[model samples]
Target: MTLKTEPFVLNMGPVHPSTHGVFRMRVVLDGEVVTDMEPVFGYLHRGIEKLAEERTYGGIIPLTDRLDYIAAMSNNFGYVLSVEKLAGIKVPERAEYIRVIMAELQRIASYLIIIGAFLNECGAYFTPFVYMFREREKIIDLFEMVSGQRLTYNYMRVGGVSQDLPEEFLPALDKFLAQMPVCIDEYDRLLKENEILLARSKGVGILSKETAINGSVTGPALRGSGVKWDIRRADPYSIYDRFEFDIPTGSAGDCYDRYRVRVEEMRQSLRIIKQAREQMPAGPVRTKVPHLVRPPVGETYAHIETPKGELGFYLVSDTSISPYRIHIRAPSLINLTVLRELIIGWKIADLFVIFGSIDLTMGEVDR
Candidate 1:
């Protein structure tokens, strides 16, 4: 049996600049309405997971950084958590606080990118984008100071972090924190109530709570869809339970809701950063371990709340210096699970708005 229908077909991306990265959308349209959508990936398959088997335990940390490339510290933290649990390594309290600080700071930085880029896609041009970056640059400066490198930070180790907080790090971080709230407000004034942004995003790309769960969506995407679920709170790890913050969620699960959820999430992350900085203790950054790191034959799955969503690492060890199997359950990939459903029955222009609202990173999605 065969059922065929005529639908105007077109490609959304693969080489388009607005895709944010190497992403292709196969779109079926009827006049101005979308009929169906399929996302195509694999343009940037670096094979890092398979390569992890060949590298030593210590060698894989830097490779994890390339997975998300946005929240590099959170990627590093999740991988190290699985490895540490597998090897029975106890990270010092001080190191854990440092990890939390870095993770939260990176989370804020990641949201800044999303807000700026999403506004740009909404056709607000450079005004909002520039406003978002002004705060993000300060966070990047903090990363550079501590890690000795910015984007591809190789500052994570299996047992713990690779470096201690620099002498100037805390004071600089405090200054950035004091200045960030005003910057976030500036972004609010620019796009929050703008009729253009609201009209484009408010009712577009609605996803229900139940559907969001079945699709395995996590992070802000799930929250935006009216699910008050956060992996950080649901499955607290690495002293995250110690922090006091609210999980901001939405009711309509539309593009506007997604935008609002992430904005509130950025504010929550800032709160976590302040708490971590105020309660920081002085101690060693990394745990003592052998040069040739190996874990007993076992498996461990460690998950953390990355800026994008629940970033998890599944590691199986066979008592070798490298993992026998590594599975990166990236939230960006899971969040894209519902793109087809959201794009249907909408205008082709809404495709741009919906994708931007989802806030995906091609690195994690394709990984």
Candidate 2:
């Protein structure tokens, strides 16, 4: 004789705010407990890869800025590094140091937004998100000072950065750094040990180490799953090898650990910025590149640890001013793979906690 069991399936996204963007999860449940889940994509497809084939080398920089809009500096840095590799351009030492500092600041700002937004999703109200962005505003101020534009600062060129750091940039950065520890402490005080947050996040959405890597998780999300792999340290590209910082890892691989990883990462990023600022060289911010670049027929891939995760830019050049092909290995899109898998067997309310903990951006995922 055989026994029969029924399965329940539900869709958690494609329109859910907590999904971070327009994405969906097909979940199968067994008696109010999810048994299996699959994450669906292509909702916000813009065919960016197809679009890149037609844009010139310089023109592609602006588009790269949109990939992980939160960490625009790092996105540009990683993409331009690939182009530089392809072009065999030499960057000044000062330019490398300046790039590191700006990228670190953007990392901190992006994490602040995720933390505030994650906390808000747990129904703690809007206070934290508002408070978080307040600090973010100051960081954006620094970016504006350095590049003359906030958000999508077209401040990176194929060879090096577009401009030198402003004279006031250091002072602003220092001031922001001094205040960050206190703000971090405030967040810890507000939600770290709070019973509600702890309950909602702890032991929820667990991802094992093997599963994390199998699903191609990176950055804090992979660390949360107990992997010590960080592209910045493992690969040590750019001036990252000159720096000393800790790669924080988590044991539980839950929402809480992911949250902690990013929080600690912010602290580490601050340390990198301070070190970079103190050691910043005095010279031109940009390397010399042709107004129009025509590279030898070749292809290269560059990966960097963005605020979200590993952001890799793959370019194929056919010795033309415009790239023959371009591909963005986006973190958000890859991180979402295990999203439904983690949320299954959990309550619908817990979906937001899991989704926000992964820390996604539509700009990158859609692109």
Q: Model 2 over residues 85-146: C-alpha lDDT tens digits? A: 88888889998998888889899899999998899888888898998999999999998997
Superposed model 2: Cα runs more than 4 Å off: 1-9, 29-32
Which sections of candidate 1 miss by over 4 Å?
A: 1-6
Candidate 2 local accuracy as lDDT?
0.86
lDDT of each: 0.88, 0.86
**Candidate 1 vs. true structure, TM-score:** 0.97
* Local accuracy of candidate 1 as per-residue lDDT tens digits, 106-166: 9888998998888888888878888778788899999999998889888778777888988
